[model samples]
Target: MSQRSIKITMSAVLLAAATLASTAPAGAAHGGEPLTDVRVATHFDLAAGQMPENITLLPDGTAAVTFAAGRQVALVSPGGGTRILATLPAPADGGVHTPVLGFPLTTGIARTPDGTVYVLYATGTADLTGLWRLRPGQDPQRIAALPADGLPNGLALDAHGRTLYITDSVLGTVWTVPTTGGTPTAWSTASELAPTGFLGANGAKVRGGALWVTNLDRGTLLRIPIRSGNRAGAPQVKASGMAGIDDFAFTGRGNEVLAALNAPNTVVRIRPDGTSTTVLDAADGLQNPTSVALRGKDVYVLSAAYTTAADPNLLRAHLRGHR
Candidate 1:
C-alpha cells in the first residue's frame, strides 16, 4: 500500500478509538483540567506548504518551527509575525526514495541559547538525511549523517546544550550525538521504542536527568535514564493508552505533560501516574496537532492538518494559574 493509503487507514483506526475514548466517563479517559483562552495565533498557508510539524521556543517568545513538507525552518514572533529562516535543498528525485512517508519532511527541532538551531530531516537518502545546524546569519548545514532507511523524528537537547538525543521511529532506536555534530551513537533500542505497524518514538525531551519519549504506534510515554558514561539505562513506561500521540511538552509541574494526539485531533494532559485528560480538541482549532510547547502559563500548539486538510495553524492558550 502507498504511504498516503497507510496514513489514511491508520487515521481511520485511531479516529474510531478516539471517538470511543472520548465518550468514556469523566476522569476515565479524560481527567485533567482543560486549558483556557485557547485561540489561533497564526493560520498557515496550506497551499503554500506551511504545515508545522514541530516547534521550539526562543528566549524572546518566538517559536522556531519546521514546516514538514515544505522542508523549511521559520520563526513566528510573539505577535504572530513570521520569518523564513532557512529552507533545505530538495532531493534530486524529489524524495521518491524516502521511506515510510515516501516524501521528504522535516521533523523535530531545537534551539540553543546562543541562537543556534538544530533540526532533523528524513529523505531516505544519505546525502540530505540527518541533523542540520543553522547559526545566526549563516545558512543551514547538515551536521550529522543518519541512516537513510530510518525515519528520524523527535529531537531533544540536554540541559547543558552539549549533547543531542534523537529518536528514529522506523528504527526503534534513540541516537545520541554531540551538539557540534559527528557520527551518531545508537543510544538505545529498547523494545518499547519499536513501532507496532506504523511510526514510533515520535516525540522526545530531556528533563530531570532523563530522556522522555513517546511511541505513536505503542501509544505510550517512555523514560530512559541517563546513566553513567552518558549511556541510556532501562526504559520505563511513563504513560499509556494515548493512541496517536505525536509531540509533547513538559508542564513543569513534575512529570505532567501536554501531548498532541495527531489523528485524534486532540491535546491531552498526562500526569506522572499515567492518568490523562483531554485538555484541547478540534473545537480549539486543532486540525491534527503535531506538537506542543509551553512557556510559563502560555501554551503553543502546532497543527499540521495532514488528515484534516483544513487549517494548519499555531494555537495559543493559557494554562490557568500555572507558573
Candidate 2:
C-alpha cells in the first residue's frame, strides 16, 4: 500500500481500536453515482486535534459521536450544536496501554429506543477495557469487561433488549453479553474472522434475523444467522473484496447496505447481489469517512480526516437516487 493508504489504514486501525475497545439509521436507499453535493453539519476545533470515530443516531434525530483520542462522547444537535455528554477514564495501568497505533480511542456508541446510551472505550490496559451504560443524570455503569488482548469494536442488541453482541477487531471474535448484566461469552469464533492485519471483525448490526459484520483487514462482510435461541449458526460471506470496510447501515432496499470504506475515503451502496456502486467518494469531499447513520430521510456521515490539518467533520448529504 502507498503512504496515503498506510495513513488511512493507521487511522482506521486507531478508530477501530476505539470500537474494538465501544461501539445508524434507516431510510429508502438507492444506488447510483457518487454524491458530491455534501454539506458539513459540524466541525471540531482544529486545535483540539480530536478524532471522531463511530456515530449512532438518537431517537429524536440528533447524533452522538465518539472521540477516540479524547476519551469522551458528545451530543450533536440536528442543527450542529454540540455538548459533552460524558468523559471516560484512561486505562488502569495493568496489562498494556500503548498508543503507537492510537490512544484513548472510544470505538462505538449505541442508543436504544428507550434513550439509554451504551459506549465502548479502549482502556489500553487489559482489565480496564470497558463497556459502559449512561442513563439520564446517572453515573456511567460498567456493564461488562472484554478480554485483555481483545479490541471490542462494533455493537448490536436484540429487539427484546436482553442480549448484546460485541465484535473484537484485534482478536476477530464476536462476544455475547446479557443486557441485564452478565459475563461476556464467545458467540462465534469462525476461522474466517481471524485477523489478517490490524483489525478483523469491526462494525455490526442486527437485521433480517441475523448479525452482520465487516472485517477491516480482509475487507469482507459476513453474516451469522441468529438461531431461535440466540445461538449463532454457521457463517456465510455476504460480500468480499470490500477492502477497508468499516461500519455500515441498511438502506430501504432489500439487503442493500451503505458501507464506509475508510482507506479509500468513500461510501458505497452494496446491493443484495453483492455488487457495489459509489454513493460518495473522495472527490465528493470524503476525507476518511468512518461512519454513516440515517434519521428518517436524511443520511449523515462522520469523517475523521486524521491526516489532514483541518478538524474532523460530520457531513449531511442526500443518497443519490433515494430522494
Give the Cα lDDT of each candidate: 0.87, 0.73
Cα lDDT tens digits, model 1, 20-124, are 445433233334465788899999977667889999999989999998888899999999988999999888877867766767889999988888999999988
**What's the residue-level lDDT of 182 in candidate 2?**
68
Clashing pairs in 1: 31-277
Stretches of candidate 1 off by over 4 Å are 1-34
Cα RMSDs, all models = 2.9, 6.0
Clash numbers, per candidate: 1, 13
Predicted structure 2: lDDT: 0.73
TM-score of each model, paired residue for residue:
0.93, 0.86
lDDT of 2 by residue, 1-323 (tens): 13344345465655543333222121123244534457887887534535677899987778898875666788999889888888776665522343234444678888777788888866556555768888889877778987756778888787777778888888778988877656888999987777775778888888889999998777778888999878888888998766678888887667888888776666877778777766776655677778888754578888877665354788887655564
Candidate 2 segments exceeding 4 Å error: 1-31, 34-37, 92-102, 320-323
Q: How far is candidate 1 from the true structure (C-alpha RMSD, Å)?
A: 2.9
